[model samples]
Target: MVGVSSARDRISLRGIRVTAHHGVFDFEREQGQEFVIDVEARLDLAPAASGDELAATVHYGELAQEVADAVRNDPVDLIETVAERIAAVVLAHEAVEETTVTVHKPQAPIAVPFDDVAVTIVRGRA
Candidate 1:
């Protein structure tokens, strides 16, 4: 684990879009849908930064892909669940000290016109 020396460093990614089939309705799984994910992580990486190693910090590219993969690969009932799951996934990285995740659904089948529906969650180490 990284020491307290390198505290409160953060990595953030915004507006990462992924096509997914996530909804409570059965037809949603059959027809599919689209989602946008935003992610941020706080990591302690003084050890890795001082040592100059790729292993020292969380890879944002890998994280973006992982978010996309998770959204596409899994079908769930709600965006809230997706956000929670993503928070857990990001915090699982050893370098990460805390994580925040947001899932957005723009094309929700609502009669009224609105920008989007979103869920945001924050998680950290025990």
Candidate 2:
């Protein structure tokens, strides 16, 4: 199998929202909030492009569900952990040579008014 490179093709899923309990605060763990996930999988797309077959590429719908399940079912204290978990899930696919996962915590309990806080992680076969 080929490894990932800067110019590799990518399949991405963005703005996937899920409600999960993930924070350092007690209120955040108890009350749960919306978490947005974005994923980008990099790999050689020549086969899929020429074949025009679903099996030739990563199934994005299933990948999205996996990411959502990881966010909803697992309770972690940090968004960094969430991002790591998402990256693992995305890299599990055989066709995915590499993946970058971003976990967005929009409603985090911050004293200052901010738009959002997020963590991004990249993982794959080295």
Candidate 3:
């Protein structure tokens, strides 16, 4: 079925834009830039779907706030680290079995012209 959701479903939140200080260059760190994040969380949707209960699933509103806090609080030199941090936050939720995170540095300090620079990482429970 095209619209049917299975037990194993993915909830994705993309284009989470925020300004944070993170980069290898000193100037880049000092002058904060907008960072975009995309996150996908895979989990069992059966409970939430069947029960129609808020407690049965992860609250995306809380997740977004937490993700924003995760990016804003920590000052790291690499986007890879930021991605990892985000994955950690997603995995922190009990319902999430796995998570994929992408951190984009649109205003990256590069001499040559470029659209964007981003780092992606996947993490799951062990």
How many backbone clashes are present in model 3? Answer: 0
Candidates ranked by TM-score: 3, 2, 1
Off by over 4 Å in 2: 1-6
- How would you order the candidates by lDDT, starting with the best? 3, 2, 1
Clashing pairs in 2: none
Model 1 lDDT tens row, 59-124: 889988888787888788899988888887798788788888989999877789899989888888
Write down the RMSD of all candidates, one decimal each: 3.0, 3.1, 2.4
Q: Which residue pairs of candidate 1 clash?
A: none
Clashes of each: 0, 0, 0
lDDT of 3: 0.90
State in Å the error of residue 99, model 2. 0.8
Which candidate would rank higher by lDDT, 1 or 3? 3
Q: Against the hidden reference, what TM-scores do the models get?
A: 0.86, 0.92, 0.92
Task: Please give, for residues 2-105, the per-residue lDDT of candidate 3 as tens digits.
Answer: 45544359889999998999889888788888999999999887778788998988999899999999999868999999998999999999999999999999
Q: What does the lDDT read for residue 52 in candidate 3? A: 93
